[model samples]
Target: MFSLIYGFYKHMVQKDEYCVLILGLDNAGKTTYLEAAKTKLTNNYNSIHPSKITTTVGLNIGKVDVAGIRLNFWDLGGQNELQSLWDKYYEESHAIIYIIDSSDRERMDESKEIFDKMIASENLRGIPLLVLANKQDIPECMGVREVKPIFNKNSHLIGKRDCMVMPVSALTGDGVDEGIRWLVDCIKRNSYLRPPRNQEEM
Candidate 1:
């Protein structure tokens, strides 16, 4: 029954598609990152009111075709009340992108807790995760070295989960290409899931 729901979810997404789940804390710039990428690619963007940014309740789905890949990008709202929705698609996701504000030193512990939730979720185990240490252009931003320690602390439990962290400045388009390319490469490498068992035949 779950597989059936997953198949329907895939079909509803897009034909010949790859789905990516983008997660982060509130004010982590998840929406801006997606919109900025779209603007950079198309050279045009429709501005959304700042008030709308505050309430991205539930999820915002974006469809983009990059290098022949039909990508279904899901931007999940970080509000506490909306977090339960994240579990519905965790098993269906091809990869997970966890974004964090590199300049927010005060929120590092909270960030770690959210990441821990993602890692602890059974549906996400063994799946590839790409961490975006964003806001690198800000003066107060933490350097990549500073971020390394946090990542190292959580590295042990990530079995078969190929994770990578890259500094990104979504506001200025810095390091965005590397992040997107990493996701595309992960999908192209067939890293979604292992094959199913054939117990009857065995």
Candidate 2:
């Protein structure tokens, strides 16, 4: 009886829309990471279909099917000229993945500004984030410890935020799978942590 009720609840009460918007400063390997994720999931199931990847001029779409859960990933082009366009998609996303260039020291300020702008936008506030310190294969690449404080400086989201900072090598596919799995778990459990909904008139 319990199993039947749980199955009914799962079918009726939860209609999930899983989406992730991958954002970062330009050349942060957003495209590479997407390809690596596709390859990783495909290899796990022995899928031979090649993923056709093109430069994400404005947006790139990648889909992953896992246990009846559909994950739709968007690769947003991260350039100053393209930044204004991101606001349009903020509300539609369930998660935000920020990629940073670990070896580039000169653009840290700009990257921070972009990160601030992301959550500050009217529609994106309260969204969870996963920060990836990419280019970890480089000898001069910055580690997660060195880059985390910059993301944590936002006091507005201190208690309400959820972020995972990790160093990854998109070239070597070192930490790509872990990152995706972390995102998957976050999406699945997002509503579990939210406070009780107010009983308001519909």
Candidate 3:
């Protein structure tokens, strides 16, 4: 009887879809990460070679259903010119996953600058943020400890938001699952903060 009621509730309740924006500087493994995630979650299970994944020219979208929740990822282009277009999608996004190239020490400062500006946006206030310290598979790559402190100064920006920095290797898919799990949990807990279903309501 209990099992029947739980089944009924699962069937009757509509699954919530959340819009997530994937942002980072060029060559930060944003596209690779997206493709890797799709390969793992969807039936299309083709292998994705990260080395062959070129820079994203615009947006590459992919959807995956996890534990009955649909996650729509907008993998935006990370080139310098494309950065200006990011704010256009900000109001619609429920969460953010910012990727950083852990191996590229020279660009860390540049990445932090862009991150600071993003978190300062009024439209993104209180939104959940997950920072992926990507390229952990590479030797000599900066780990979470080394890269996290750079954003520590701007911690106040996310004081009211759910934020986390996690180490991940987009190439090998290590740590990606754990990071995404945390993000899903955060979104579930704060579903009220999501954008309205219809634009008319906004």
Candidate 4:
């Protein structure tokens, strides 16, 4: 009886772990968003000052527990050369968080181009996508309204999957909570199709 009771307790304590990808163009605030998320979701995590956070040449990884689920984020470098390495992690990922620097109007088209290409991949099909319009705190940043139409134009590519485009300021932590909550709910609902691993993300 003791052994059985212990097993039940273990089952209760072990969380379903999901791997998520954080992708976007360089300087689009992918790492900042990841840091902001860690700071907010995990207790006592000190976020790096934005000025001190340099461009990610390789990858940045972060793990946080939210709503009893463990989300392992593999934040790949967004530089053009590094993007080629993104596919290496996709098969293991349960979701994708594509960050966009809404403030960079000059590169909005380029960002959209990459987003479309990434979404068009067969490996990422049926996966939930959370598109975050980062750097919304900047007064000159493009509004979410402007950002939506760009992606929405390719709605056919986004077909039938759980997806959202949300405005966020990773620096200020605004919209992070709502975005994460939405993502968690989407992941749970889609687990039947792509079940989360019992072990931590590799």
Winning model by TM-score: 4
By TM-score, how accurate is candidate 4? 0.95
TM-score of each: 0.81, 0.79, 0.89, 0.95
Relative to the true structure, how large is the alpha-carbon lDDT of every model?
0.76, 0.76, 0.87, 0.91
Query: Candidate 2 lDDT, tens digit per residue, 38-126?
Result: 77776464332324544568788887655445667899898788988888888778778899998998998899888887878766556
Worst 10 residues of 1 by lDDT: 193-202
Q: What is the lDDT of residue 78 in candidate 3?
A: 92
Q: What is the lDDT for 57 in model 2? A: 89
Candidate 1 segments exceeding 4 Å error: 1-15, 43-52, 191-202
lDDT of 1 by residue, 1-202 (tens): 9989876766555345677788988788888777666655543567554345655777888766676566678999987777778889888887888889999999988888888878888888777788889899899889888986796586666666778888888778788777877777766675426321111211
TM-score of 2: 0.79
RMSD values for the candidates in order, in angstroms, are: 7.7, 5.9, 4.6, 1.8
The digit string of per-residue lDDT tens for model 4 on 1-202 reads 9979977887888889999999999999999999989988999888788778888879899999999999999999999899888888888899999999999999999999999999998888899999999999999999899899898888889988999999999999999988988999999999998899996322
Scored against the true structure, residue 60 in model 3 reaches a CA lDDT of: 93
Among these predicted structures, which one has the highest lDDT? 4
- TM-score of model number 1: 0.81
Query: What ranking emerges by lDDT with the best candidate at the front?
Result: 4, 3, 2, 1
lDDT for each residue of candidate 3 in 1-202, tens digit (9 for 90 to 100): 9989877776556467788899999999999899888877778678667767877898999887777688889999999999999999999888999999999999999999999999999999988999999999999999999988887778788778999999999888888778888998988877876742421211
| Better structure of 2 and 3 per lDDT | 3
